[model samples]
Target: MILRSPYPDVEIPEVPLPEFLFGAGFGDRGDAAAFIDGATGSSVTFDELTGMVTRIAAALHERGLRRGDVVALFAPNSPAWVAVFQGVLRANGIVTSANSLYSPAELAHQLTDSGATMLVTVSPFLDRATAAAAQAGLPDDAVVTLDPVDGRTSLVDLLGSSATPPELEVGPGDTAVLPYSSGTTGLAKGVVLTHRNLVANLLQFTPLGTTDETTRILAVLPFFHIYGMTVMMNHGLHRRATVVTMPRFDMAEFLRVVAEYRLNRLYIAPPVAVALAKHPLVDEHDLSCVDVIFSGAAPLDAELGHAVARRLGCVVLQGYGMTELSPVSHSMDERHPDDDLNGVGYAIPNVESKLVDPETGREVGPGERGELWVRGPNVMSGYLNNPSATAATLDADGFLHTGDVATVDERGFFRIVDRVKELIKYKGYQVPPAELEAVLLTHPGIADAAVIGVSDAEGEEVPKAFVVVQEGVTLTADDVMAFVAERLAPYKKVRVVEFLDAIPKSASGKILRKDLRARENA
Candidate 1:
């Protein structure tokens, strides 16, 4: 029983991503602000942004980057970062974004798996990027820094004299961005999003009343993540809105930017919502200018949502999607401000969804909890270089199994009930259990390990490890956590560790994560 979007479908363009974004139809909002650097108060207007994109595109093309070539971007949110992303697309090269906080090993895996020949990063990350590049077998010249440095080539040097964008045979089907995701299980694999998938999602989300020339969006979310890539960076620029970019989320700085810029919209994850609800710092600043807040990437508590809404006197809503869905399928329409805050809201335009019993593989009726399966123009083409995983995820009928357990109400609103996958969401970032277990096994003291998410006091899911230490080895929980912290991102570090005699496993040697979760609850 498939449920369709309540809204009417809109036309999605079939042009290449660059053409669709910077084409002639958009009127003279050219002088309007496109992106603002929150820290330095620097601004880039729409007209200037287009020129920078074209120049960078021309430079990349002149430097021998061609269509289908992969260029990796490893940086935090900034106006320059936006230019680099669009520039890569305009050059007909696929952009593979990496988390700026990634360790060398983690970054190397993505670079090798994505087949990225060139790496672009900022000065602060140069050491790690260089190490990762060497590990991935990339040449020294392939690592380009954002700023000019003594030994490395800077992006500025590549911005040659010409502002002409590269001419290439790009089609709607051509892959544009390769953001990595763990999907339902395993280590992260590159999600192959084509030009049409992203453009379609932009059009699908436009009717939600978040985009316009007059809009000022606070971009605290990382652009490397799909949720930020689509909703904040692409959508904001497409609408010619001013985006205030924050390199990192500092509660006081976030508030200061909002007050200073009079930012009217906020694109954020759930942990920020908790701060808005409980943190006294929220009261110290004037947030009356904010008219709406859209929270995504993880589930936001209904009561907490309401509390923040009341505190800020703004509309607070939640949305749901995965990287495979161009990161947005259902979002609360700002036009219908009275909709229930509990559900993630109705499907966006042109999206079709159904709830199915995971065991039976049969569609379930409305209000029944089942794994969500979505089919839409915004669904990704496949996982890069992993056809078997892609086949397992995308069915012959075209629905992409989300691995998220949800229920659709009679009115077609969807609420996530549970997750069927082992991917843990720590403040909306994917932390694969298998990846952590692999890291744990590398520790000499650890004989075996299984990882599962346990809800912290703040209601956020955090990775907790149950370890089987080698005999005669005295391994403290701090020692286990420190080992992971040295090799993984701060968010991916295990927060809790429990020493165990043995990790429960199936006869096939698969870690029984469900058993560990049950033990945590017990």
Candidate 2:
């Protein structure tokens, strides 16, 4: 009952990540612009990028870092960030990327869990990085800045005098990047992606676009996110396209950069698409150069997608994937654009998908809603350091349970209906309910708490807390929200609070989230 990809199978190369990315056919594009700093108007050519990668790799090797060591990157999007990421790979080390907006506690958990030996970040985040490093039991020198500071070791200091890259044996099956994701339940875990997984995804995504040396791509999405890491940064470099990087997203600045650079391709989330559709600032700028916009990370409403496409007079498409699937399994083909705009489109090359009944464990046919099970070279190796979690996610038959409910049309297109997991999607970023509940329980006045996502006025899902207060203590919603706001990122903050007499739980003491969701909707 497994449904295969409509496209022909693609050849997945067995070489290491660095070799597959920078080897044989990538030469002669030396002078082409690889990445551009959107703010500073600075540019790095393909030849210079390769040389920087090698120098950084040599520096890392000289600093006593050996193959298989984990290096953490905690910086915003920039051309330099790209070099640092690729440099880690070229050094034969694993790269663990952290969200630039993370709080110190959040960062510390990732650092400790990933066992990162060194942390690389910018000066703006030095205070938080230092705090997190100390909390994680890393040395003072373990945290370094990307740029040269008065007293800190900059990335330049680690660069070796020689331009030759270090030579090391890296297998296709070796773990390359460790990106954190909350699979179906609980806190985030490190997703172990191998060299083969990344290379295969890159090859699989090639036919979906017409990117070339002349293509100018706007890369405003955070590189720490898997969608940006693979589709925008890695794919842009592999295609030798001109990529414009933004440190953060500002509506005015985003439009200015697009008009200034004449960027043609945009990779963004659903919320940004809403801005393009309804914001008046969009009409003030000249966005005629944009040819395509691809939305991912969350489901984009069909009406909003069409509105943006109509306003821009361009094609708008959606794709679907999780961090465990190298971030993309199905995307709309550039060659045959869908007019309906509801489906995320057909599976890309080399990936197969099937819809199954979650309760029955039996495959369902087209036009029936069921949990999606995908199998492909793009599937991750497993969750790092959590064999039980890995066993629960990746099956013996090699399919990764996505925990998302979807339906397939007769023509092979797929559309997401709902999520079966408790992870809330706040404008595409994951907000785990269990993590928020754990934080709420720490408050002295709170006896019990349960969190669930409720739709806001903007159609985006936000975290709402239902709390049970201590018998004689009084607490306000602001106090409850301020407590969480101090420890969590802005996106993970509790947006709404409701006090209850008691929390509904099972006999085993597990909070029934489905009951809370139903109450919220009712």
- lDDT per residue as tens, model 1, 1-522: 888899999898789878888987357788878899999999988888888888898888888899999999998889989999998898889999998778899899999999999999999999999999999999999999888888887878766546456685689999999999832255778999999999999999889775788899999988988988999999987887889999988899999999999999998776577567766689899999999998887666676678789999999988888899998999888888787776889999999999998879888988687899999999999999999989999999899998888888898988876667767889988786756775776676766677899999999999999998776789999999999999999999999999888776422123556678778779
Q: Candidate 2 residues 67-116, lDDT tens each? A: 89999999999999999899899899999999887789989999999999
Model 1 TM-score is 0.82
RMSD (CA, angstroms), candidate 1 = 10.2
> How far is 261's C-alpha from truth in model 1 (Å)?
0.7
The alpha-carbon lDDT assigned to residue 22 of candidate 1 equals 90
Q: Which stretches of candidate 1 lie over 4 Å from their true place?
A: 182-184, 422-522
Index of the highest-lDDT prediction: 1
Least lDDT summed over 10 consecutive residues: which range in candidate 2?
Answer: 504-513
